[model samples]
Target: MACRQPPLNSKRPRTLLCHDMKGGYLEDRFIQGTNTEDCYIFYHWASIDIFNYFSHHMVTIPPVCWTNAAHKHGVAVLGTFITEWESGKDICESFLSSEDSFRAVADKMVQIAEFYRFDGWLINIENLLCPDAVKNTPIFLRYLTDKMHSSVPGSLVIWYDSVLEDGKLKWQNELNNQNRVFFNACDGMFTNYNWKEEHLQRMVAIAEDRLVDVYVGVDVFARSEVVGGKFETNLSLQMIRKYGFSAALFAPGWVFECLPTNEFHQNQNKFWNLLCDYLPTHSVSMLPFTTSFCQGFGKRLFFRGKEVHAGNWFNLNAQEMQPLFVDQKLAGAGGSWVRTRGCSEDAWNGGCCLLIEGALVSEKPNVSVRLLSLLAQASPRLFISFIYKQDCSDRVRLALEVTTTNSCSCENSQITTPQDHRKGTIPHLLPETDNLVSQFKKQCDTQPVEGWTINCYLLELQESFLENVFVNISRLPDADAKYKEKEEPFAFRVGEIRILDVNSLFAAPVQVQNLTMCNTLWRRGFNDCKKRENQLYLSTTLRWFYPPNTAVNFRIFCKGMEHHQSVTIAESEKMVLIGRAYNRVYRVVDIPIPDPPVGTSGQVEFLVQPITKEGFVGQSSNCSRLVVNYLEKQ
Candidate 1:
């Protein structure tokens, strides 16, 4: 129902995302920090869970996770109100029989939208309608839109290009007079896939003023009709833009479904980057980021260490990045539960810990928890905290390993090399036996000291590397004989794996200074350079110094003085990590000149914030603040 709030006004051509595959569950992969500028609306396909026109059971509400994630990106989300086959035909006949029947259906649809917090509905009437029902279809749609708009100001009602005004189940792949009647009744129209270039041009002409309303459909994996299916999806986008029309990318989950599991992240990026090639980046400012992991709090399935909630699947959203599992499986035939004394207390946020009672032993040497996504581009000084309970006979050992490259091989030697630099990779290497036990003793207070001990391991990598970090637990080889008699399995519970930024622990903040401006034509003897004087092209460079081992990547943000709280303009690419204890100069090009306040000099001030390789900024700066003041040239 209509639980979603209104989205911000967008200047880019609308990019409508149609969620249809695997029953709208696969869109989870897109939540991770991906660019979403062109995505104006997200449509969760088909509301045929049940087949009553007036019952909420028949309404297919958009998943709450999709609504939350889409709205966070300022994109509107819609649920499908669909009718198909004989049941759909019967429902439509009842829905369109009279004015009261039409109002009843419209009010129910609005109520569903309100309950679910979604923006609107996608009316897909794919069944053939009788002559009387066909004649009143527009009236029903118009009434629905009017009621929806009056109740939810920024709500939408998209007309799927399925049924025409004449009540025929014909797919008009373009906007013509046949479908223009319905388009005029709703917010916009989703063109059916298989449209020609001329069709796009014709639709664009018809949508002269509201050209963004026309979303040309491009099915990324619809083998029969989609052109340039995989990495070449840009071809369809190029044509849509050529005619100044919006684009609807159907089933982007093809990247995940078709590619090998190990190559999912790489292939997903390659596919979406093709879309970025055609769509411009929207200038929206994002807040500082933080992520933490906890199991048993809110999780659905556990594959090893990765835990995903059943109904909630949007893991890409920054806020929902926790409760990850690596390789969880059902407790098998050999697995047996045992009574454990205490649970490991959660280290990040105080919560109940996850208990491991069954025989966790397997043919595999270790079970690992991945931490790279949280540690990517982060400071080298990191802390991992978890709670576990182990007796003197317990043989389980916890090891922390980091792999620098994206190779799926878990071999320690292969991880050190800079072979494939993509994001997904396998866990590699275990801590040395001596180091593992010693570190555990140093970090944790075991049984005699306390029933369940909290362990916090502090790690400092020597160099900044794009790497995947994993925490693994393995059984020691020598302890099997001790359990031979009664076959009692060793049990332990693990709390959350908290990734702490150790750089923030240091009391001293870095210092920044020496800001200077330069024009494109500036040279040693170019002071007298003569081009169009009014058309000045300027860039700025600044120097900053961090304490030993505290180097971090930084970005410059600018905003107009009058709109101090408005969206900040990111003016520079991330500066590479500075060398320890050294002064580094960063140059930003094509910086937009901000308007000065009414009575002040023509000067603009910008803030420089340090960011991790993973694009995380701390809520508060432990580092010194750097606000550069630039004066306008007279």
Candidate 2:
């Protein structure tokens, strides 16, 4: 559970999305599961700096899926430790009863976060506190904050704006003297959602230099005096930015819960698009930058351009680094424009691909889409490669637009200077014009997979680092074309992208070892048939070991086989995506007995595949596997 990922260290005005839907937990609680139905998965990790998995439960730990997805995008994820109502009063009395007990509870929270590999917690107490509990509240918050910081380097413990210091359950709606004590006890505070313009101004004054720490609350459901929630949540976001305060958007999942299911994807993008302009931007600084623009859910699953599983599936852990796509509405005046989003209908890799589709009219011949934001150091010799399928006749150009500066020292040499210099490659001697350098690559003859073209470009930097990458799509000039009459159609799907140091060689991760299953829970269920024959389902936690720092992601796959089979054959077995893991531990749920028969057992083989931070997956032969007995109902 030791976190290998870096922590959030930005000082900009940030956005923290608190996800709350219905009650506490649901299908996502299973972590990894066989269910392939549509689920509420947050894809706007680039816009938000932090994510809080909120619910009414007393100790609401975020599912590993949320943590994995958020961390993959360089976003921090937090769990909720909340107590509310009459039952919460009893719980508070027991935890806040004595100094030792409150400290012990705080320690337990730290342990939970360490084991789950999440960032931190959001402490919410909504019930009236007794005199003794009120006296111990600040003590508890201070202890939790100090412990979390020490235990998990950049972790946070934010106090919600409720329960006044006088032991009254009063909502101040702003950071005032009543709750300033609690704010002083933790990293920051989440103001009540009913806050007004004056409240924001007052909180800014109270927060002083830590202004960004005070996350002004915005309830997306439009509940109780909440300004511009739901579709117009941007109003609150804009106002918060105007006052120089961070934002905590509660229940942004309103798009999934209240909107039409069929239009969830588009509507979700639209909703986030409205607020994206008001939120702060985040950049990827790590080297070997890569992404498929996958939102981590799809109608089916594909690996290296071939179909792996054909079923509707969603697992946030499978999400890759998302792109900051330009809003279609703001792209143009309708003459020509391109809109990009993850398309699950088809993909060259993973479950989704970046779909760039638009029209080119007489007025507009080419469209440039800003794809990714990078702060990585450009190597002396750099190699950039990507996979895409051009479904239209229009020509597409992908380029890296870099703005580099000469550092005081040769720090870039440590990050990416080429050690191996061979023939046919040259140093990037091209002079920078207007402080910007653009590197472009043409479609090569290499086709590692069918239906996709690979484009690779090499650049050698003297002392500069990368800043941004952009993709341009243009219509090739045709003498017979009649662009003045009609608008031409253009579409492309980018399945994979990688920027690597030419000198850096890829080392496949060591095979996973010590694979084990524990805490197994089984359930008796009936199939979809009318016969009502009994079936067995399984839920268990899987653990394995791999050499440290070998990979950033682990993909868990399972296949069913006859118990009598001793040798594992590839073509005869179907590999299903059970889920993904950020670390060695993963919990799988509701794995139905494939073709379960009365009193018959089979063998299940689980495979662990390690994937590098730059999307390079290890060879199947180098991966590890475990076979477990599947017992059917007698």
- Tell me each candidate's TM-score: 0.45, 0.82
Q: What local lDDT score does residue 90 receive in model 1, on the 0 to 100 scale?
A: 97
Instruction: Tell me the tens digit of each residue's lDDT in model 2 across 225-275.
Output: 878998899999989999888899999889989988788889898898788
Alpha carbon lDDT at 97, candidate 1: 88
Error of 2 at 393 (Å): 2.7
Query: In model 1, which runs have C-alpha deviations exceeding 4 angstroms?
Result: 1-11, 24-58, 283-634
Tell me the lDDT of model 1 at 217.
79
Q: Compared with the true structure, what per-residue lDDT tens digits does model 1 show for residues 161-254?
A: 9887788899989889888888888777888888877788677677777777787877788667655556777899898888777777776767
Candidate lDDT values, in order: 0.50, 0.73
Which stretch of 10 consecutive residues in model 2 shows the poorest summed lDDT? 408-417
- Please give the distance, in angstroms, between residue 225's alpha carbon in candidate 1 and its true position after superposition: 3.3
RMSD of 1: 21.6
**Cα lDDT of model 1 overall?**
0.50
Off by over 4 Å in 2: 1-9, 329-334, 395-447, 478-481, 506-509, 513-544, 552-582, 585-609, 625-634
